[model samples]
Target: MSPTIEAISAMPNGEKPTYLLVMLHGWGANYQDFVPFAKMLNFPGFGYFFPNAPFEHFQVPGGRAWYALEENEFTGLATSRKLLLNWLTSLEASTGVPLDRTVMAGFSQGGAMTLDVGLTLPLAAICSFSGYLHYQPEFQDNKTFPPTMIIHGQQDPVVPIEAAKKAQDELTKIGVSVQYQEFMMGHEVQDPAIALFKQFIQDNLNFN
Candidate 1:
């Protein structure tokens, strides 16, 4: 069976969609986490897809997680990446949008996954919020860079600001065109971050 996916799509009254944005949610959250923000975006000809993580988070009832978070285990990260990739492939098959016209954006853990999948896939852009790139060193020899925007909170306790900075530095070292922004908040996404996200999409997607 195909993976479960929840999506919201918008197109100008007469025009076909030219771009697609995939929003991946943070840990312990479901597809609904991005619905409100997706609605706030002003991409008239862009279609949006928000897919729920494959696993259920232990701590939060009725909440989903990309993978299980266990001590000394990075399996969750790998699992999430594969599942997301599968979902993206299925979405492309159904929507008829080429991978080059697709963008992936995520928050927190989802942000990390966005970086992982975006780098490995042939995507146009990636936007990450409250997240960091953890596997930059591995991609050094691969030398594939996607236009990426990273937004983090200066006071984020879950993922430290220092870690985010380090991730930016590593990506820059490898010639990745990365745009980094920080907000005066915590682990949550703030208005400034959202504004930057909007601008990043508009600039990269060429939405008039």
Candidate 2:
């Protein structure tokens, strides 16, 4: 059976999409949470897809998460990875955007999911903001990986800046080219981070 996904999309200049940017939202947030940010990063000749998580948040009404926060995060991550991959495949089929021209990105838990699934796929680039690697042994092997960038706030009380550092080290150990940046903010993607992300996209992915 095909997976059902609900998302918000924005096309560059209202023209046919040449590339895809998949943005995932953090826990306790809905798909639309990232729509504005996606638009800020929207470059010409690229399309954006902001997909809602499959499960509803336990506490926040109208909020969603890729998986339950109360459960083992690794288990949840594994399950979310499968569901996201399936949805991505169906989306590609429907949109006619090849997987190679796609970039995956997210913030916080969404950022964590980006690392979880994006690294495993044949995507052009990956970006993480306030995200962590979630540290799996299997993902730490030498291979040609998609170019990746991670941005985190140094004062982030929720995820901590160390998570991004660890991710950078592990990705480097695995021979993945990675760029790491830190901001002075707390648990947020600030303007500077977005600027860096925009540059990361232009450097690593092709939109024109």
Candidate 3:
């Protein structure tokens, strides 16, 4: 696995983890941020990995960013994308979980990244919460994508709901099977969304 990004992981208690879940924190958040969040899911027998973004946040002390938000074209995005892709592709070797049984999900900027690299990989599924699509997609007409879940807050102030909708539209146009949801909240995860997320993972994972 690439040593470029630092990460933290956990295995289910009393059982051998049979699947892998990679959670990417949003901009300004560190790997530690998702530790408790993962617990909230109450998922069992699945290993969890939370990878720290490579770059430091320019404004928030002790916070990290996938890329800087200064340029009209997000600077650092390409670099982060490459590093994340490398790390994810190499992950199965270290975790004993193949990409076909792995799910890559994220929030905010990290969610943007979920779509960024997740679209290109043969992951079991990819999910984005309160996230947006960064680039104008240029996929082939017949390309197939993993099962995707896009969730956003109807009253979100940070990332407008429209961005999520636009992402849904674009992805659908490309023949991606997407399950989109709009919750009754803001720029944060809530109970209902968590339930949906859990179900989504269970439904897509190749577990008998």
List per-prediction Cα lDDT, in the order shown.
0.78, 0.82, 0.89
The residue-level lDDT of candidate 3 at 170 comes to 94
Give the alpha carbon lDDT tens digit for every residue of 69-128 in model 3. Answer: 755778788889899999999888887788988899999999999998999999999999
Instruction: Tell me the lDDT of candidate 2.
Output: 0.82
By TM-score, the best candidate is: 3
Of 1 and 3, which scores higher on lDDT? 3
Q: Which ten residues in a row are the worst by lDDT in model 3? A: 1-10
Off by over 4 Å in 3: 1-3, 206-208
- Sequence-dependent TM-score of model 1: 0.88
Q: Which ten residues in a row have the lowest lDDT in candidate 2?
A: 135-144
Scanning candidate 1 in windows of ten residues, the lowest lDDT window is 2-11
RMSD of 3: 2.1
Of candidates 3 and 1, the better by TM-score: 3
The TM-score values for the models, in the order shown, are 0.88, 0.90, 0.94
Where model 2 places Cα greater than 4 Å from the true spot, the runs are 1-4, 73-75, 139-142, 206-208
Better of 1 and 2 by TM-score: 2
Higher lDDT: candidate 2 or 3? 3
